[model samples]
Target: MGCKSCGSGTNEDGTPKGCGSKGACNTSSCNQRSTYDWLSDLGIDDPYAASIVEVSFKNGASKDFYYAPSELEVFTGDNVAVETKNGYNVGRITLSGELVRLQMKKKKVREEKVTESIIRRANTRDMERLAEVRDMERSTLVKARAIARSNHSKMKITDVEFQGDGKKATIYYTCDERVDFRELVRQFSHQFRIKIEMRQIGPRQESARLGGIGSCGRELCCSTWLSDFSSVNTAAARYQNIAINQAKLSGQCGRLKCCLNYELDTYMEALEVFPKKADKLRTEAGLAILIKTDIFKGIMYYTYKENRGLLYPIPVAKVHEILAMNKAGDKPIDLQSNQLVVEEKDDVFGYEDVTGAIELPAEKRRKKRRKKKSGTNAKGRSSGSGRKPASGDSRAKTGEAKTSNTGDKPAAGGETKEGSRSSKRRRGRSNNRNKKRGENASAGPKASSGGGDKPANKPSTPKPTGEGGKGGSSSSGRKKRTPRRKKRGGDAPKGD
Candidate 1:
């Protein structure tokens, strides 16, 4: 959205950085290459604010001035219906107030000649109908081309625009030779059931009507704000010291880009300071022919027959002195001896590469993974977990790990370690609760279940952690361990 045309993109916010049309940033503010209304922000109430206003139709493909009725309020970017030759057409206000007078004067359009009056601001119904009418253009274009091709017409129908009321349509086209579209128009009227306008235009105008992205990666200026297409020639490139690349110079219209003439005047003014017809110079190193010129630098590069690949850059003043000397029957020592030293800068893409060594995070991660796998693959694996004490760690490592391993162990009390901790009391009264639960379990029916036949003080042995443990060995004064469920989908995939 940071494009220049998107300056007046929003209704009240400050100008956006870009014209949204450059990409698919179809914001509401980007009303088909709208110009930002900077004057409106001045907040000065002009007496002639509601004069004739310039309106943009079809997203600026065409524009016309409409007289703004003093009774009605109007502003730039307002959608208003204006009078047409046949019916009312909808267009957005682009220029109004005092600016309209300046534009009219520039275009030499008489204010009295602007007879069309603004009918009214388009309402909801009118906006909806306008959308429906525009949606028909895509399919209409396809059908239009088919009808023309069936009639064996050589012209290509570039675009189709329907009237606001949907009672008439205009078909724009381009052709090299004259075409008889009388029969084509008759078929169009019968099929479309409306008035048909067959408008013939040149290639440039055709491209302007149906806009496209230019080679410069922007919307065609003709479709945006470029109302006129000036003739461009190869001379503009030569004057600016540009290579005459036809493919690069050509535009979407298959002609030289109109932008070629944008800075042509500036190049012309700069070239006024350069000496013309100074292509060759007689020197001791042989005849030096002009190779290239740095126009802004006022330096000209030349190559001699003796040094074919090498080039010597000479200033304009020095070239003139040598030319005057040659005219007086004198030759300089050599073009190189009098050449200006052009400093070569090693710059690339606005950035420079500094050579140094640094470690890549990805490589470091890979090395860490290799170290982790090597460390984990080595056994006892259980000791690294720091779970059991120093001596019991070796015994725990012999066990094949379960899918779900418990971090908590059973306390001396009948209650398991997980069930015994009662929130903060465990932090404040840990020993008291364990001792109390043990005393209670030892005194009651839990006591009968605790030691039933064997005595409670006997030390217990570490049973095998897997499948062979006994289920009926509750006589060991310890809770019977329940077998863990096998993992779903059989064994899990191997890597951690």
Candidate 2:
């Protein structure tokens, strides 16, 4: 089959470029045409050399060219004149002589004989003169712009350069519309007293001339290795699947970066391994279009109606088989016999039965038996050995019943009542005795400590006898009379 990528192009050696990932140019030694080789082509004359150097021209113009011998003659610091169609351009001789051939070939420029020209040596005068030319150029730019403004012109004097000979100064400017700057140039020549040349340049060219490093962290291609610029567009980005962010896509030249075109073929190659998004496929239940792909995982998914229109996953190889069958105008064969099966992988469910047979659930477990109590049982509470209530008395009953039925003290005044009354009478007498004793006890201590109170009666009062008037006059005196004696004897006997 014809190679499945971009159609054939010429190789480096002038052979036909093929379709696969590899595209080589038969003309060059290391003959591949690729991003890396594009850079590699700039350094050496023989196309086989790996490293390449790039060059950029004034006005944001740049190109990739093979390094040749004529370009490598001068050393890094030595000033050398670069041969140009207009004139010999003086610059620090970066690469010279033979290196130019390699740089040129790297750019894929057809080899041409070098122009027989000698870029002359630099001297002290040349250095000083070049500096003077630059100072003059700067000053001239200001005057040039002023002149243009005075003339009601919109042109801006962007740069000025003093010719190597110091005989002429070139003024570089840019304008939206073509400007008649003849008067501006004449005025500048008169002011600086030198020959004046006016040159118009574009924005990219301006950015290239005043170069800066790019986001890629390298010297700008326009200033270094590119010689010509081609119009770059959004399509270059599209082909590489890059987003069209202007700032990112544009280079230091304020134009699309030339590097955008470098890896396009690689991305194109990668896409081949993936399924074409345009082709629609039919499954058992529904029709499905190829919506997306994941090439690395080798996974393809098909949407079908019955499965809630959700995509079902199948391996890429399986999809390829299905595609082949469809392409051959044949129905898909049953894949169960020929299907490639992945081994059972995980313990989504746990351990299998160890006895090699399924076990049944245990029959309803038996209920346990209880031991009965020997005596009267109480309601609500579990009984152990129970005690019976005593008859005629309620205190011996269960704690709750006894508490509820018993009034203050056993009975008020029945038999138990009479006992309570007697107890109360004894308590009353005892209480009175206690009260008297308390008063006597309290008074006795205070009286003894404080001395007893004096009595109301006289101190000499006579003591009374049991049967007589006074003890001193005794019963004998009273017995003087016989009656009195008998009465006394009888009284004495009675006393005994």
Output the lDDT of residue 403, model 2.
17
Candidate 2 lDDT over residue span 1-496, tens digit each:
1211122455465534531122222221111122233321243344343222222222112223323244444322233334454544443322334455555675565545434343554556665655566566566677777877888888877777666556766777777898777776677778778778888898777766666788989766665445557777788787665778998998865678878877776766766765554255544434555544554455555554344345555666676767776678764533232234569977696777677586778799888754333222112231211334355332224332221122423211111111222333332233233333332221110100111122111112223334544222234333211111123333532100
User: Mind giving the per-residue lDDT tens digits that candidate 1 earns over 368-394?
Assistant: 322221111111221123234233233
Could you say which candidate leads in lDDT?
Answer: 1
Q: Local distance difference test, per candidate?
A: 0.66, 0.47
How well does model 2 score by local distance difference test? Answer: 0.47
For candidate 1, the 10 contiguous residues with the lowest summed lDDT are 374-383
Clashing pairs in 1: 2-17, 2-18, 3-18, 3-19, 4-18, 4-19, 6-19, 9-29
Q: Alpha carbon lDDT of residue 377, candidate 2?
A: 16
Q: Where does the lowest 10-residue lDDT sum fall in candidate 2? A: 443-452
* Model 1 alpha-carbon drift over 4 Å, by segment: 1-30, 33-36, 342-357, 361-496
Clashes of each: 8, 60
